[model samples]
Target: MPRIAYFGPQGTFTEQAARTFGDADLVAVETVPLVLAAVRSGEVDSGCVPIENSVGGAVTATMDALAEDEPLIAVAECVLPVRFSILVRPGTRAEDVKTVASHPHALTQVHDWIAANLPNATPVASTSTSSAAVLVQDGEFDAAVCAPVAVTHYSLETLATDVADVDNAVTRFLLVSRPTRVPEPTGADRTSLAVVIAHAEPGSLASTLSELALRGINLTRIESRPLRGQIGEYRFYLDLDGHIGEERVAGALAALHRNSNQVRFLGSYPKADQSPSVPSAKNTDDDYQAARDWVRRMREGR
Candidate 1:
């Protein structure tokens, strides 16, 4: 069994996610940065880091580490469903709640719930969701927005149930490993690659993307970031369906090769894991908006 690392503090949802994907041999770390560092250091065979949450959109820290300084390649995925509860001192009541604290991501997930129910209460951010629970238990705050597991660990009360405002929210976690020489595709694969085009040349972007369309390949995602040492130049990072070994994918890449000055393939791997459902009316809208409002109150209260 391979060892995997993820954000942890014993009972965090990140730890649960690691255990879900890693079986019983998972190691829990403190931060997304540490998870990436552990993989780069080869201390673990792989690491799992949350990439995006339905509520929060993207985990910007994880994206920056994967995009900027690291050579880690995404290998597998874990889609973890998030359900949040408000925990507070054993005797705390809804009327007595003043401020709520939780990890930024956790706080964001349950933002809607807090906004509607805790109108006057504030939300605070802690190092981890579990820590937020702990702080809420010890501090004077009325409550903490945390996981159910954390509520049990902290011996706090769940002032509200499923207050998260959304029933089907999920976070996508990527299992990354040291870059592989050639990745073997499991069915339903996605390829991730980075390319640099002539900054001043005409039709450069067109020529690159057109090849994929011409070959009937689906361009799933296209993102751009600055190329190192060049302020004006940017590198395009893409995720598309089809493996490099496939003829159409190969030919399109070849066409891109001829059209662009240079291309660096990060890796061709699995598509991201995400929920399968129509966007909930409240989830993308109400749930997220509510969560944002609650987080604003919490941050402002401090």
Candidate 2:
């Protein structure tokens, strides 16, 4: 059985995502770095960790790890519905709760609920929501805002269910492994890249993005993080709507390479939602191939 590492003590959203990645021997690590390190060191076959949430935005731990000097590559993407609950030790009444503990993202997800209901409860951060549940199990906390699954894991009781302020809360997770193990791209795939501009100029961001637009590549997400040790310098993380294997995507990346200082090819994997059908157009792969062939013919003649 494959040994998969996940950000967990168990029962966190990352564990749920690991399950979505398929059956495996799950190893629960305390932090995102541990999970990635396990994979990089060959201690595990793969690592699964949250990358983004619809409500709270990107999970910087996972994103920064990918951007850093790790020889890992994302192999798959898993998205899971996240539901938070106010869990407490059995026999702990809701009225007796004076503190709420959970992962920071989980805390923010249910902020309004906690404020409206627990009003004066002190909110504490834990490594993971399941860790918060463990705290309650050890009598360290009065209650925890964690996944419903965490209740059973730590023998806690749910004081409230679906406590998240947003009913549509979802967390996106990425399965990462060695660079040699990249997954074959589906036509309806997403290519992730960590791009650093050659200079921090006014139009640098726009110029880098224009390469994608010029090739008709649609951007699904773009986020910037400060470069380490470089004040006023930023690196962009992008998710664009095409596999790296596609012609237009390859062309765009080639252009980006010429325009940027460094372009880290994160990985290309199937989008969580399968490719939607085009009205009356050929499949993207066929179109890309035909277009490439035509362009090659024109270049050869020239």
Candidate 3:
């Protein structure tokens, strides 16, 4: 069985995402950087880490890690609904809680719930939700806001279940590995890229994106991260609605490469929701091929 490293001490949402990779030797690592480093160093075949959450937007650590060092590619992805549980030692009453611990993102999602329910408890941040549960298990904290699976791993009772401040909150996780054979395009796919525009001037970024817009590609997400040590410069991470293998997508990527100062192909894989993109008649694969053929014929004096 292939070994996979995940951002965890186990019982994290990332662990749930890693399990979706089917049967594999799952190794729990401390942080997202460590997970990707394991993949880069050949310590594991792949690494699973949270990329973004519906409530909190992008996970900056994961985004920045992906854009730096030896390139790693996301081979697969999983999206899990964000529902937290407040776990405490058996027999602990809600009023007795003084400190509630969780990951920063988890703390944000459950902030309102915590305030309304455990108003006296101070919220504390931990490296991971499961780690928070570990602290609670060790009697370091009064309660832990963690994934439901955490209760099974730690000796804790659920004080509250199915907790979330917002409805339909979800987190997206990526199964990344060192660049290898790209996954064959599944009609319902997503391609991720990191691009740096050649200039910071207005319209420069828009002009670069026009490459995709002109080809009728749909962008699902775009985020800007400041470039390390390069004052005033930034890197843009983009998630588009098609695979790199598709003609229009390939054309757009080629254009981006030519226009941008740097273009990094993160990966192209099936979207977690498996929803296919709806392309217009003028931008379909056949349309692109026809355009290519017309240019060839003109050059051939046909």
Q: What's each prediction's TM-score? A: 0.73, 0.84, 0.91
RMSD per candidate (Å) reads 15.4, 3.3, 2.1
Scored against the true structure, residue 121 in model 1 reaches a CA lDDT of 85
Q: Give the per-residue lDDT digits (tens) of candidate 2, residues 1-302.
A: 99999998788777878888878999999889889989989999999998998887999888889888776778789888877879988787766888889988788888888888887688999987877888888889899988777766778888898776888878899998888745555657888899986454789888888877766778889998988888777888999887777667777888888878778888888888887412124435567688778999999995
Worst 10 residues of 2 by lDDT: 276-285
Candidate 1 ranges with C-alpha deviation above 4 Å? 8-13, 54-56, 68-70, 89-96, 104-109, 147-161, 166-170, 181-184, 254-262, 272-302
Q: Top lDDT: which candidate number?
A: 3
User: What would the TM-score be for candidate 3 when compared with the true structure?
Assistant: 0.91
lDDT of 2 at 273: 82
Best TM-score goes to which candidate?
Answer: 3
Instruction: Report the lDDT tens digits of candidate 3 across residue range 171-202.
Output: 99999999998977889999999998644567
lDDT of 1 by residue, 104-207 (tens): 87787777777877888888878877877777767856787765666656777878756565788888777888988656555456666678865788788887
How large an RMSD does model 2 have?
3.3
Question: Candidate 1 — worst ten consecutive residues by lDDT sum?
Answer: 275-284
